[model samples]
Structure formats: structure tokens, C-alpha cells
Target: MFFRQHRYSNLIIPISYFLDLLIINAFASLLPIQFQTPVLFHAYISFGWIVISLKNEFYKIYRYTKVAYILRLIFTQFVFFFLILYAFIGFFKQPMISRLALAQYFVFVFIAVFTIKFLNYISLMRYREKIKGNIRNVVVIGENKKTNQLISVFKDRTDFGFNFMKQFSAKSLDFQKEECFKYIIENKIDEIYCSISELQNDELTQFINFADNNLKTLKFIPDNKKIFSKKLKFEYYDYIPVLSLRDIPLHNPINAFLKRAFDIIFSLIIILGLLTWLTPIIAILIALESKGPVFFRQNRNGIDNREFYCYKFRSMAPNNDADQAQATKNDMRVTRLGKVLRRTSIDELPQFYNVFFGTMSVVGPRPHMVKHTNEYSDKVDKYMVRHFVKPGITGLAQVRGYRGEIESDTDILNRIKFDIFYIENWSMFLDVKIIFQTILNAFKGEAKAY
Candidate 1:
């Protein structure tokens, strides 16, 4: 329900933002500059600023997020806008881009969009608190230290919204069914949160049956399971509790949505806008060098143990899946055109489609073959934990020199360590920095690129 409402809320700002951009562009065109260039540039600039705002998490509807937090985010958005504008203008040395107009547009957009978003967030929080609507009522089913801690945290934080109608002790089987029924009847509970270890299969199944009959939500709070230790950070949703088993890096919902939104829009621009103009040319070269399929699709594990077929331009002689080998330096399978593609990282362009499909991120731990996953899971400790988040086109490990074939166990271990570090310390600034470093590294040709 929250997700649906959030989606509906998103529609309002974007619509208002589009009108604001149109006005900004209209204002930009009035100035003395190239008519089309400045107009389009301002439009692009507005779009970029909006994306940065969303990426920086100005859109997350926090129930009790301090007013100071909201202002800090707004200030960060202004900083990003000016920084990006100046950097791009300086890098391109384009004097025609109207600085004053762009600055005005930034101010205009920030005021209009920021006000709408803030109002939406404040209004939603008020609605949830005022009408007592959309706040999930949750019951914790456990009698252990973990449950005690959970209760203590919720009791101290009223903004969490769980109301904490009652916590049922899971110590014994006697009076379990009757007490559970009584709690349901008296409290009018809407959900159940349980510690994973506290309940056996039979008890869990019984509770699940009751929950199903009662039409309540059942989410588990996992203890520091080794798998969760990799990236999970549990958080409460109002009074309702949830276990965050995987960290998608963008903690703020709007930031995460923006990162992904940009990935899709950017990937579409690359594939449809750019690749359409480049594919036939590259295909001819590949066909001339090697008579085989022009693309390669391999099954790779993605976030949450899902498998997706990752695509890349064929740079090798289409090896059989039954007898595949990882590419090494000066491999015989690579064609002359393939070498150029591999060196320039053009072969991975097709994966923009993977990003568009929501199976990959523009930056994250790169996905490996299922066979490689199995082989390395045994060799490297906590290797599978990297699969908690969507694999990326480029990652912190790749930037820090842990790409290419894992020749040593230490290499794989260090790579996993870096991947986890990136996951834990994820922020928009970090992602932007990694992307910049990736571009610079590609230009200098790192040793791991092979």
C-alpha cells in the first residue's frame, strides 16, 4: 500500500517539474545565445538537477525525519546543481551556455519541485498520523533478547508507527494457540514480526496459517545470520518492523529510484539513441573477422539469487557453454575486432539493456557466470554475499584493482571485502566518485581490464 501511494505521489512532482522545465527553457531562449542549444541545455540541466535531488534522497517520505534533515538535503541539492553545472561548463569550455539563465533555472526548479515534494511528504505523514490510516499494526512473536531489544526500540520511538499492540512470548507450546487467537481478537493486529530462530517449522506453519486467514503481513527479523552480515540493515516501517536482508546501496527510496531511473533513461539513450547508429558498423567488422553470432548471452546471478541473461557483443568465437573458459591475456578465442572491443570496453555496451531491464546497475559488483560463482563460493569466504545486490557494469573492486581472472585466493577475498565495503558505505557521492574514477581508469587502461 505504501509502495502504491509512493508511486502515485511521485507522479505529482514529475508533472509539475516538466512544466517548470518548459518554462525554464522558454526563459533561457529569451537570452542572447544560440536559440536551440541554450534551450535544450537548460532543459537538460533542469532534468539533471531533478535527478540529482532524487538521487540525494530529497524525496523519501520520512514519518518523523527531523526538519533539519530535510533542509540539509535541500542544501545538498543546490550544491550538486552548481557543482555539476560549473564542472560541465568548464570541461566543455562552452561559453554559449548561459550561466545566469542556468542559475535562475536551478533556483526556480529547486523552489517549485522541492516545495511540492516537501509538502507531499509532510502531508503524507500527517495523514498517516491524523487519520490513523496506512500505519501498519505489527505484533512481534518471540520471548528472547532479540524481541526485547525490538520492543525497547519501538517503545522509545513512537514515530515508527507500529503501535506495538502486544508481544507474545514464544517460550512454550501450552496456551499458544489460545493466546495467539486472543491477541488477534483484542488487539486487531494487522501484521506479525518474528525472530527466525524462535519458531520451528510446525509453529511457523501454524502462525502462517493464522496470518493467512487473518489477512495479515508476516515479515521476519533475521538475527545476524552470516548472509545478513554481508549487507543487511533492519529498519522499522512505522510501528511495523521489517528485516532488510539486502542493501541496494541507495538507502533512501527516492535515491534508489533515481539511480535506477537514470540507469534506464541513460541506457535507453545509449542503446536506442547511440547503439542504433553503431551496431551495423560494429557488426560488419565482427562478421568480417569471425563468421559467428554477433552477440553473446550468458546466465548470471543477480540481486537476491535471481538469474538473468546478460548480453554483450560477441568478442570471442562463440564458445560452447558445455566447455567454456574465462578470457585471459592474449587468448586465442579473441578476434582482432574483439581485442579492440575488449580494450575499449565496447563489448559491454549491450549490457545497457540489462540495466534497462532492472537486472543490473550502472555501478555495483560485476556479475560472474553461475559456474564461476560455484567455483569461487568454495574458494573465497562469503563470496555469495556479493549477490545480495544487483551486479554492476563497474564496481569499487574494479576501480581498486581486483578485476580479471582470480588467479589467487587472496585476490578474490580482497575483492569481496571491497564489494562489501562499497555496499555498506554506499551514497550518491560515492557512486558519482566511482563513476568518475572509472572513466579516468578506462582512459589510462588499468592492468585488470584484460
Candidate 2:
């Protein structure tokens, strides 16, 4: 199974350890300090590293090679090792540890660890070339152009290790009962890749059930390219494999809990501490200008296109529903206080509470009004993918000056480009950078902001 090919490869651990040691040594050699107890310090560091790696699940094999995942692992583990070292050596004021050794340890370890993996990948490629290993005997259960492409790909890139065993046409198969099972048994199949659209619902279900019962691997390659499903990890029940798409990036229990904790702390500081003071000032100004409500509420599309009422300071006339025209520069709709609120982004202060409630994120693709969503989604290609994660108070597009009126289709399309790019290349560092840039942009006063 492609998923389990690298399972239980303790090789990854020792490689990591060697890499860490090399990095530490390199840093140590550059520093002035010398080790009083080199062996004991080395053992303590090595053991601590191993325990940290296990706790972080750095050894668990991934389904595919992703730079993001690997970089994340390296960063988290690097922090853990350094923090532990600092506490044990720096705070305790231990002189036994060499500063040079510590520095070398970090650099060498990281380099060695990733290098070994890269070499291992190269070695595997060579091995596959020699023995024809890693070859996937693919049984594509479709006869569409996509299936034809798959066959062509296999023929073209034998290096990719695909060996097409047979092609199953939906029209020819008698899928009323055990049809897939009978076919598989007859063909001596290794794996099944099915396009859900190629078969009727009942037939697809029957085949899936048969595959589950037989413990065979089932890979779904949907024909709808617009949907943009990703390679997700599967959960098994006995022999049954269940596939999932909405594996929330933050919903990983640890990350979810941590993000929530940060949100609560952050929201508390903003709402009770900061907004408690700013809201009244804004309200008085807003009330004096417009003679209406202090806050505006409207439906915005959230994760998975779910509707949620987003809150903001009433930055326009009280009756401006989402159907009203988008606020434009020097538009008559802008109230005196509304101009300031929108300019400095004081209108978005209410969303801290939304973030606190876990309905919105501090940084993500900025949510659009439900009407705008319906209007622009059709106009912009792959527009719906922006809803893959929770909408944000600000986003990459807004930071890049794509806010305010969408006068042109190109504007909406470019905004969607940044949104999709952010989703595909998301990271904690990216989020932090976006937040920082949003703050800087807020003070600079975005030209597009009405």
C-alpha cells in the first residue's frame, strides 16, 4: 500500500539523530566554550531528542512528500530541542556543556537528518529503477478521458511505477452483486483507483463495500476538477477503509486546542481590555453621525460555505443590507465616522468575539457577503476553494490591497488567486506574517479601503 510503504521505518529516527549530532558539533566548533563532560552531555541531549521526536510523532510516515509537513516537523522539533537544552544548560548555569557543541548540534542535526531522507529518496528511486520496485499495478475502473490519461501516464512515466493491469468500463460491468469482487479475483488486482462519477451511486457503493471487506486499497480520483479534494488520511474499521475530505487543518486535536487557547487569550485582551474602551467612543461618534445602530450584522460564507452572521461597527447607513452596492471610494453612502472606522479597520473590531467563538480566524481568506459570494463565485474560477478554511478578519488579498469594490472581473479573479495561494501554501509563519502585514497595512491606510 502506498500509504503504508514507509511504515515502521525506524531508519528515519537514527538518521534524524545523526543529523542533530552533526548540527550540534558544527555549532560547538564555532563557539568559544569547551565541554567538561562531553559524553554525559551528548547522551543527555541524544536521549532528550529521541523522547521529544516520539512525543511529536516525527516518525509517523506521511502519505506523500510535502515540503510544508517536513519543514513543520523540523521547526517544532528544533524548538523543543533548543528549549530543553537552554533549560538544562543555560538556566541551570551548567558549565559542563560546550556552547560550541550546542551550536554545532543544532545545525548539523537538521542538515544531516533532511539530507539522509533526501538521499534515501534518491536511493529508493535507484532501487526501483533496478528491481522495478515501488511499481503500482493500477486497475482503473473508468473509461473516460481521465482514465485514458492515466493509461498514457503509466506508459510514458514507467519511472512513476504504474503498471496498468486492466481497464473496467462502467457500461460493461454487471455491478448488481459482487461484480467488483468477481472481477478483482479474476484479474489478481493489486489496487483500485475509481472515479466516483464513472459509476452509478449504487454500483459505486457496492464496489466500495467489496473493497472495504477485502481490505483492498481504494483511491478516489474524482472527475470534477473544480471540487479540488486533497489526499487525506483514511481511518479503518476492522478491514473497512473510510475516506474523508474535511480534515480541518486546525482540527488536529493538539493544534485545535492550542489555536482555541490562543484565541481565548487574544479575544479576552481585545474585547474586555481594548474594545471595552474603543467601542463606546466609536458608538458615540457613529450614533451622532447616522442616528442608527452601533453595530452591523450580515451573513458571510464561512468554512465549507456555511452561513454565519458576521459583526462589524455599522460602517454605513443602518439599513444597508448585503444587497446594497459595495462601498466605493468617495461614495455618498459613507458616513463621517464610517470613513475613519473603515480606514483604520475599527469596524472589524467586533470580530475578535467571532474569533473567540471559533467561528472566524484572526488570519484567513476574508469572508465576503453571501450575495457577493454567490455573485463572484460563478465569475471567478476556483472561487469556492477559498472556503476550505474559516474566513478571516483580514487575508493575503486584503494585505496586498485587493479590498473594497470589485469593479472588474479581473479584480475578483486576482483576489481569488491570492486566496487560493494562501490556502495551498498555509503555515503558522505565513499566518503570523499576514497578521503583521495587516497591522502595518491598517496603519498605512489601504488605498482600496473605502
Candidate 1 stretches greater than 4 Å from native: 1-248, 321-324
Report clash pairs, candidate 1.
160-238, 160-239, 161-238, 161-239, 162-239
Per-residue C-alpha lDDT of model 2 across residues 1-450, encoded as one tens digit per residue: 342232223244445456656656455545544656556555667678778876887654432334466678777887898787766686456866656666666666667767765676556555555667666566778777666765676566555555677777776645334565676757656568776667776766666555543434566556443333357655431222324433445434334444556667877888999899988998888888877789888888887677888999998875544454678789777788789888899899999989988788887888998888887665655677777667888889988878878888888888988987887676677777888998898888888878
How displaced is residue 123 in candidate 2, in Å? 40
lDDT by residue for model 1 over 308-367, one digit each (tens)? 899889998866741346788888788888888877788888898899988999888889
TM-score for every candidate vs. truth?
0.55, 0.54
Look at candidate 1 and tell me the lDDT of residue 325.
64
TM-score of 2: 0.54
- In terms of lDDT, the poorest run of 10 residues in model 1 is 3-12
lDDT of 2 at 356: 88
